[model samples]
Target: MYQVYYTRDKAGRITQKLETIEGITHSIDYSYDLAGRLIEVKQDGTVTETYQYDANGNRLNNAQYSKCTTK
Candidate 1:
């Protein structure tokens, strides 16, 4: 069986998600901008991925985001 848990900040934004399966625990942490847009994803306190957007909130291409694990 698997279990999941979530944590939220006072501003009501999701801050973390944790999942447990077969005695192994995995987690993902979240960050947001003042506008509440998701900005970064981390594991074990290391940033592994990021997101980009135009000023109007349109998703932007991240050709410069070298940290992305998948192309």
Candidate 2:
């Protein structure tokens, strides 16, 4: 089994997530614009994803996700 922990802002936006698997844990931090639109994700303190949107709330482009490394 796995475990997931989340931190949400008062605006009901998930600001962070910590997931555990096989007793190992990894965390991702979320960022948003003032309007609460998702903008970026930092996995283990390095950005691994990005997002963009249009004024009409349509996704302008595909988000990027890649393996995160710790050095």
Candidate 3:
């Protein structure tokens, strides 16, 4: 069985997650902007994802995946 652990902020938001499997450990970290919007994601201390939002809180694009279009 694998083991997983999480670290949270004062507000109970998960700030970091650690997992161990087969004697290998991996970590993921979460970051938020001032407005509490998720802005970045890191895996093993390397940035693997990024996010951008519009003024109205609409997701504009995701750096790791695809872009969003407005109709």
Q: Per-candidate RMSD vs. true structure? A: 4.5, 2.4, 8.1
- In lDDT terms, how accurate is model 3? 0.89
Ranking by TM-score: 3, 2, 1
Q: State the weakest 10-residue window (summed lDDT) of model 2.
A: 60-69
Q: Which scores better on lDDT, 1 or 2?
A: 2
List model 3 lDDT by residue over 1-71, tens digit each: 69999999987889999999988999999999988888999888788889999999998988883334499
How are the candidates ranked when ordered by lDDT, highest leading?
Answer: 3, 2, 1
After superposition, the stretches of candidate 1 with alpha carbons farther than 4 Å from their true spots are 62-71
Model 1, 1-71: lDDT tens digits are 89999999998888998989998888889989888888888875677678889979986854222344566
* Candidate No. with top lDDT: 3
Name the runs in model 3 displaced over 4 angstroms: 65-71
Score each candidate by Cα lDDT: 0.80, 0.88, 0.89
State how far residue 68 of model 2 sits from its true place (Å): 5.9
Provide the TM-score for each candidate, comma-separated.
0.74, 0.80, 0.85
Q: State residue 4's C-alpha deviation in candidate 3, in Å.
A: 0.5
RMSD of model 2 against the true structure: 2.4
In the range 2-71, model 2's lDDT, one tens digit per residue, is 9999999999899999999999988999999877888899988888888899898776875777774599
